[model samples]
Target: MPNPQLGATSLLTLLIFPDVKPDNILVDWELDEQGNQTVKEVALGDFDLSLKLIDNQPLRAPHAVGNVMWRSPEGQSGKGVAKPSDVFSFGLVCIYGLGGGDMLILDAATIKNLKDHGMPAEQEIVVRHFLYFGPLSQGLLNHVADETWHTLFTSAGSIAEEEAIDDPDARFERWPKDIAPHITPEAKDLIIKMTHLDPAERATIDEVLEHPWWSVGVHNG
Candidate 1:
């Protein structure tokens, strides 16, 4: 039934059956209360749906209904999950979120090259500035220039400069402080660990769980 407190009213009702030729179907329902709407769980053979009702309005379009047969471990009946598929999906989501869905890290490498040359340093500086904003992929730049690693660190405060090159934890220096609130501490820790230029020194997932941000509940969600 619809919760009267939320001011919602169902205007229609529907039922679903898997064995049915059309697979999907719709039906009409009546509402006894003024402007009252409620959702009722209904099971029809291999399918399931919610039936609801709305106030006395003209009977218009039919409501949509779908079937549900199998049930997964989480009680989701439509689809099943495989361990390998789940792992693969997690990897994809991680890549998409970190790189802003952009696959061009080539620009990043180009800027690193320009910093290698002796021309005005500001040009390379601009590239490195945006690198941390997302993952950089191949062929994103207009030209190839000599760029250096130090150019990426130009914004480094004195503390960053002193420890960045030598410390395993220095990748945190890449993040701008202004966006700190937007980043959960666990995420920050993961980014720091994952972005380590020296892959050998990066922190593992188990290690990241012990980070201050994760320990304090920032990653609970």
Candidate 2:
């Protein structure tokens, strides 16, 4: 028997693309002799808003960068972005990919309407986020620190739903019809973990890539 040698260990570099959407992801597909399509390689691009953190701490920016419709709570807050920010954005990208672009935490049309009506879409988006990922925890709301959210939600982590705005036409209509039953448990777990409302609670991007969903072959179950 031959002995196996240990190679150099890969170091963890906390990098944040801050913006991860379907448009930024590049995938190269290959077809085998049997005409089976396989993923040759996958790459991330549009690093104009990308950042590499020296430590695991959040990277604060002057203004809100990244795609508006696909930004993480922290990133959009104009405060800072961390590994969990990337996890949340990429998690949404995964949802969009799996659902064939059907899942959107905040749709552009809704945002446009809110802006047109002199309403901060952040409030509505918060409402949609609560519907999609569950209510915003006190820790998350405190971190984001949006004025409207702080006013609408109490320090006890309860939101005043009566005062919140909503998109009557598309308030999570796709959740039950396009998600839930269609997504695998492993995938759902990973995505939910990645998209945890609290950055402190969400898994790091490293943990996301190393999740069992990628290794267990339980995606169909």
Candidate 3:
């Protein structure tokens, strides 16, 4: 049920889903009579973790959800979840789908290995972000309630140059290259915009919808 506290809703009304991985989202296609498919709609499910801000209050607290692979960097930190968390997760889902079911560093086997390492799985995922996206901002790092994470990054929120090692995976950097098929630059740019390491820097849901990638027309890929 929709929260009564939300009262009337408009295009600008904001709601946060603490978990927005692909598992919680569904897409439907408008099929033609000739047995062809056309994507027409997307539905968000599993509102058990859905969140709503009341009276302009900020959302803060531990999250309850699964699927560490798709969770946002900020959510993994102690900053609590926000709308950008959903954007980050959704951006990953888009990457997964667009890349033809492969995002090298984010594969299940890697996440399982991290889970088995007896540390927070997000720690390694954060490392991948640092390597690929440059660095986490101090403003973003300040939200981390855990002091241990401080040792892994520099004062500028970047991995130390001497200790840094690139993943060399078939991800954003390899898009439209030999590792990836003919994915468009517009597509790559949109995902980067949505998945900025700093939650505050992530594109809003509206901005993502308005991205030029959507204008390129859908391809089966």
Q: Write the per-residue lDDT of candidate 2 for residues 1-221, one digit (tens) a residue.
A: 00101110132253567777888877777888999776656667777866677665677666665776677777666655776777788877876766625446556787788889997766554555555665567677767666754565442223423322343323233345445444566777888888777888998656876677776623363
For 1-221, candidate 1 gives per-residue lDDT tens digits of 22211221111122111122112322234555696543443212323332222352211122211211111111111111122111222222233334322321225555567666753333332222223322222211211111332333233223344444454332333444342444554555555454332222335333443456534533342
Off by over 4 Å in 2: 1-12, 33-35, 54-56, 105-111, 120-122, 145-149, 152-174, 180-182, 217-221
Q: Write the per-residue lDDT of candidate 3 for residues 36-130, one digit (tens) a residue.
A: 87665567777776657776454555552335677676665535467777778877777766663454245666768767887555666666555
Which consecutive 10 residues in model 1 have the weakest lDDT in total?
67-76
Model 3 lowest lDDT segment of ten = 1-10
Positional deviation of residue 201's Cα in model 1 after best superposition, in angstroms: 0.2
* Alpha-carbon TM-score of each model against the true structure: 0.25, 0.74, 0.74
Maximum-lDDT candidate: 2
Ranked by lDDT, the better of candidates 1 and 2 is 2
Task: Estimate the overall C-alpha local distance difference test score of candidate 1.
Answer: 0.30
